[model samples]
Target: MVTGALAAAGFAAGALLPPRPAFASEQLTIISWGGGYQDVQLRKSFFEPFTKATGIKITEDQWNGEVSKVRAMVQTNTVNWDVLDVGVGIGELCSHGLVETLNWNRLGLDRTKFLGDDKTLDCGVPHHASSTVIAYDRTKLKNGPKTIADFFDLQKFPGKRAMQKGPTSNLEWALVADGVLIKDVYKVLATPAGVDRAFKKLDTIKKDVIWWTAGTQPAQLLGNGQVVMSTAWSGSINNAVKESGLPLEIMWDAQMLSLDFWVIPKGARHLDEAYKFLAFGGSPKPQADMTRYGNNGPANKDAMALVDPTIGPNLTTSPAHMANSLEFDYSFWGDKRDELNQRFTAWVVQQ
Candidate 1:
């Protein structure tokens, strides 16, 4: 009955798909960035429910968002991963045909219902929107920094700070901190001068910055008082606060919002099962249920309405939170990632 209801809603492609033999015992392999976020937000919300609903077993795996591994699998004709949860590299993946071109009709998803520009996403369906925001331990600092610029101001908030060890959000935050408006972030980043400006601003806090590679590091750093401020994924911080009772608070100003997508490897062996799960995962209720475990916003337009009112205001897409946010430009990064990543790496090693 529930599955039928999902199909009626026009996004439940799994229920609409032809049924598989009950005894076939086929299992779908899914790979994602594993941590508390995947364990709770995705596993609880989609994986377990998807398995129960479809009766198709799922074997989950973890990846660090390596596009090259996906490329190698497709190129070598050893595509083992059926569904992938990818971030930041969808453009290159689609352009290179590393992933399958989605059939919205087959999936039964309404393009209008999903967030993000259709032109920007062609190979995958966005499941949730998460943000990287500057977070501080409120218990430690009575008057915490409130803006992206404050994160870079060592004099005012004199202490070591944490930032992801990458060019993506760090570059954008630096640009915003240096006085670029939120909407013009990508525009300013498109030129050499703008890139230099971001790096120059980063230079201001270079010595005092502690770079983090793991998603859990920021919240952990804040909890341990290793750093007073850090740019962290919203879900990670929220999970920390909820589970550990940390007094962490996020600075929503200039939060960098990014979407995580469900993509199929170009030649997934379990194509049918992948599509079934993809469609089921895109449904509004599952997307909204994701937020019950963490703060990531659902991608389905209607899912926002379904989200618990208590959780809605804390989401990255919330009107109050979005008033000063910046959407991460995957397209721009698609073109400049390699170039800027190398530059960022070289800069990080310098004095």
Candidate 2:
């Protein structure tokens, strides 16, 4: 089964490329989950300019099960994907050994230019940052939850609240609920006992909360009044506020900040082209353009300067916004994710 999957991925990757002479101009394949507004901006701001500059033809393939595909490619040594965009958690896991270490200096890329410091540096470059925030329908709850802790405190902020079912943002929220300081979140989660305590706290509200698997779902529920207080993606919440015309407000305090990255798998076929794309993708202009179009903040700090002040204040990377929010520790979760997931899943089922 694994061999067949790898062969199929290789064929798919090859089939998407525009034929080019070997060792002349490289053909790079970018395996992304889907082309949302971000994809449109990438094409106009990054890909087109990159192709014109480097003479490299870039092709994109939509693959949802990214980790599986990357693993298959690595095992078969038939790596079809030269560039990939993945969540921060998965990016950290890949950095452990699954992906190639980026040569930033050789690519003329400076890490200091990005939003988060060199702490986010590794096998990939940070793409965009967003927050998991409490969004409440002003119509339903005149006084909504002001923080993540309030979102969990059903007694004070009584409502049918929605939260992500996955471990990505939940564990951090759980730790906060259990009275672990935000700065010491991962430090506590690093221990097996800390992981247990997080789940135990989650069990307390398991009956009152609705679990959402995807980012879009909770926002939809919020718009429809299916949920009054919920943890939602900042971008999705902004969309709901605009589309529904509801008096929905995001509580930025203690909001869990998350980031995504652009990565290259080990043994990729087009290393030079991929590096070119990464460096260009991380630049100020392209990053700013993407944020303007998608309402998602860029990882390039310089890009924030170019962003419109009206939209800038709401972005996760904004200085004002980042003040009250907490940066999620991807490294800690990446190391102990399997165990955390197993325990969280069992606890959810028991609830």
Candidate 3:
């Protein structure tokens, strides 16, 4: 239900999609980060068009991004979701054989140059891309933050701040603000002292931080003047600005780019139909549609050509912004999530 409320955004499909079919197939319940991000964005860009094209009635459900919930369904052989649009844990689940094996060729995808090295795992089709970046009210901070270090420089950029209530991107930003190179974030985080150092940096502004859990909260917090700046998902803040006329601007410096994937759980009831949907969604046109309608970048690099040039400036992978960005180290999180989360949890409760 958290995913449901967190995603308050918009949706629309592309005119580029081919004509829809007169008929539809059996229904499938796809799980994803819900609310408008799923209900509006994917439904318009991919699902509705997919149903029209192949006659597959796609129903969507929200999941809390917990691997254990997915594991429970897999182990009990009660997998209801046909396709899962999941985040960072795909690598860990794939390693444990919890997700179905992906067939790159069958999915109508090549080695995706979209993600630099095509971070395509064997168990998932990489879909849309997003990033954790600093967003500030241009009206509030006339000359705003342009880098992660600016986020920590309270003296120069003084304002109450809103940050996600988790250590994932926060730790990375902490280190970067402490003068760690973008490329060296995860490497430094892998060590005990590295983590301590990140937390120590965070302590500098701990009292000033307004912790947010839902994705929508950061945007809402900023729009309502609860905080002048926040680290927010690209899609969430952009959608809020477009919808509510919030005078927000995203600072792309050292943005951590990440991609979500569509995966079939091992015991999916609509196995074959699900695979068809997976392939359909990954096609270039729909990926472009998603970018056009939402804040995410396309997982397929070729999609850039199809998307209107107007939105290019806001994209995470745009030529202008990509230079200063760093791709998130999913493997680092996959290997160290438990250990790191424990420390992060204890730190949060202390003050």
Best by lDDT: 1
* Number of the candidate with higher lDDT, 1 or 3: 1
Candidate 3 local accuracy as lDDT? 0.81
* Residue-level lDDT tens digits of model 3 in 322-344: 89887877667877888888988
List ranges where model 3 is wrong by over 4 Å.
Answer: 1-27, 116-120
lDDT of 1 by residue, 65-115 (tens): 888998899999999999999988887787778899889999998888877
What would the TM-score be for candidate 3 when compared with the true structure? 0.87
lDDT of each: 0.86, 0.75, 0.81
Give the candidates in order of lDDT, highest first.
1, 3, 2
Who is ahead in TM-score, 2 or 3?
2
TM-score rank, highest first? 1, 2, 3
Count clashing residue pairs in model 1.
0
- The weakest ten consecutive residues by lDDT in model 1 span 6-15
In model 2, the worst 10-residue window by lDDT is: 16-25
**Model 2 alpha-carbon miss at residue 174, Å:** 2.1
